[model samples]
Target: MVSSFSLFISLILLSLAKGIQGATFTVVNRCQSTIWPGILANAGSQPLDSTGFELPSGETRTFQAPPSWSGRFWGRTGCQFDPSTNQGTCLTGDCGSNQIECNGQNAKPPATLAEFTVAPAGGQDYYDVSLVDGYNLPIVVEPMGGSGGTCSSTGCVTDLNRRCPSELRVGSGAACNSACEAFGTPEYCCSGEFGSPDTCKPSRYSEMFKSACPRAYSYAYDDASSTFTCSGADYMITFCPSSTSQKSANVGPLSISATTGSDNGPTESGDGPLGINTSWLPNFVTGSSSSPIPSSSSWTWPFMIASAYLLFSSF
Candidate 1:
């Protein structure tokens, strides 16, 4: 019977090419204005293909995701909407989803996440770029071709709404609120019992957002260095990422030197560490890593996994 129906349609196209071979997420923006990005897909992943759109300022937008697939992405700043019922609203990551498509809705915090998971069979693909639900703008997450050795690049291209903190600014500045949205209690909203992490620790406005985005994820257990990993990767996700300087005329406050680990330089500290008052950080905004995840020894990935298992046993 025609070679068993062409080996059952080539074994169903190699099992749908293993979910289209997972990962590939591009999403640049380089910001000058025009934002709207949003995505959600987490609790039981699978939803990629526009969960929101409109990029504009230097556009970019690629997609695809299937293997483990987890998500979270943000960027919505100052929107308007309403070109005939497209509804509107957004001054910062709004995912109340009036229209721009955040169908599964999520980002509605001070907003500035990236988060990912991927990796199912090729394994290892965590990622990060959160501001612990606060910090509207500046994101990074590079990782390409990924194959371990830690596949680097994480973000927070620091423009911290011009150093917010006249009580988490937000209006004249546009976004920067998250001392648990300006002091809601439970000690900056770790919650109820300061909810673990051995009872909420970091806070001086999350150590000045961890001294200006030191690998993002500033508060909420921070996860060691704000988690990062890669293996069989492919992700770009830039936003105000050209390596800092997203408009700054020195908004003020920055005696710096909050001391803590190293990224090769500055880490001093004096009247800091919760003693607060490092002027308020007029600079620190670090981010610079994008090269690693190269190590490959040959046999072309075991000869393409034994030629896809002998073409799925000759289908």
Candidate 2:
């Protein structure tokens, strides 16, 4: 009887361990100002903990993502939220939900986005720090302790807002607007006749963003260079990651494999790479939900297993 009970307990623990296998995202705000980190899971996917939360400067928070999770994350600046009404707005990267938690809402463009698709096909995590929406903050996505395939750190380390074109500038040195956002033309927005990569060529405006951040998506068609793949890795998303002037510059150690030679060099149009075809995947819908399911569901099985183990031992 004792042997059978021990075997059952062992099986339960093993199942519990397997259930928790997934990726963790450590979000850090290294900026001198406060930032509210926002998360938007892909439509029909399980949401993570608190879609948005206030992250004071120099603070860090970690959240787990279930297997095959896909989403985008951005930092919101200058926000004021009220718990009573659950309504508010942010100066930059606002989801316009009138609340702290985005609750499945996507950020308005002109905000830098850290996009991710974990455990996608081929067992690799595809990720990128995209400026295609535009630029608001200096963000970095560093993969930590992952095996298989080159896990390179990708982000816009340079402050694009400082060098934004006069016409494409948003606020007084706040965020840089994408050419699409600035002009809204078919050529700039990559819509209508110019939707294809051959038609919608890189403009001089996008070149500025590409020059500043080669590893990030400067436009909608940028994929080959910007998309990085890593297997079984936790990611660190840092906003305003440590500049030389700050004492708390060293947040943590990072390991980056060198980018593939195919996409490393600059192109004729100043885009990171050329000759890469653009393939359209099913798009994730961006909207809002009132109540999202909690992420604590993963822990329930473990708790129940522990209780069962204790009960079996007592016998």
Candidate 3:
């Protein structure tokens, strides 16, 4: 009897160690500040733009998978805060000099930055998951501040190589009131008053006057504007485990480019706007691990198989 009991105990222990399942899952909280419920019209001209939704303090938005949906999840499509609006626009507001406008009021803000299991149901070993802006636009992952250096004029152009001619100019289609900031490549600056010619201040005041006007355009620096320096911009980061053993990591690190102005880089394929194609992938993930899940448990075969089986079975 004793021998039989020992054998049975050993078999149970072996089964628990080998066939017992563990999971490697993922939790993602694609948190961002770009998704405002109401249209952020031309609030740029008002202090409210700097302090309100146009650029609220500590305000954040998130995108997540709904309760009834399953499959490769995505959200925050073309997430943008328009600064202008036309007639018949129901949802109207302001960003500053511009008026916020939208066609409807049912626009949902992006989901909150959350960590949902990506591996399997009821398993703690989650895949490393993170929230990202659609097309990974930096503006969406990490939005520009009301005083973002990107829109600042009179700031430094750190990379002289990328700088447009000191005397570059734009056409009437992009009027002076809307003329590009002399601080950055001759791109349109967010102006105080619309429909007039605006000129960037001479190089002398580039640093002194940057960020003075919340909605104005200026150059970005690594240090002081006068010093032609700036710190990196902050990123909205949220991480979840790949396994029960992994811990969550949520951070909003400021990521500085070699220089500012990359935000305004031309599009890769289309002439849609004056900025780069950043709506798909964020710039911060450039050299980091690009796996969809966030933990180390995903490497185990049993966990992988179990997770796949469970996920497939649900479908």
Q: Evaluated with TM-score, which candidate comes out highest?
A: 2
CA lDDT of each candidate? Answer: 0.72, 0.72, 0.24
lDDT of 1 by residue, 88-203 (tens): 88878888978899899898888889999887764787989888778878887777656665677777766787776777877887888887877778877888888888988777
Give the range of the ten consecutive residues with the poorest summed lDDT in model 2: 278-287
Could you tell me the TM-score of candidate 3?
0.19
Backbone clashes for every candidate come to 3, 2, 71
In candidate 2, which residue ranges exceed 4 Å CA deviation? 1-20, 83-86, 120-122, 245-315
Whole-structure CA lDDT of model 1: 0.72
Q: Write the per-residue lDDT of candidate 2 for residues 1-315, one digit (tens) a residue.
A: 776677677666654442356678888887888999899999766999879999998788988888788899999988888868868899899998888889888998789999998884338888998988888888878776555775867787666665566787787867878889988889888999999987876676666666557778988887777889987677778897635323333332121223321233455553433221112111100012321112232454566677667766776
Q: What is the per-residue lDDT of model 3 for residues 1-315, given as tens digits with 9 covering 90 to 100?
A: 555555455544533431132211121233233322232112121111111223232333332321111121112222344445422221212122222332222222111111112112222211111111001111112221111233211111111112212232122111111113333233233234422233323222222112121111232211222221111111233211111111223312112233433333225562213221222332322224453333222233345455445544544
For candidate 3, which ten residues in a row score worst on lDDT?
Answer: 129-138
Clashing pairs in 2: 87-98, 88-98
User: What lDDT is reached at residue 51 by model 3?
Assistant: 19
Q: Please give the lDDT score at residue 49 for candidate 1.
A: 84
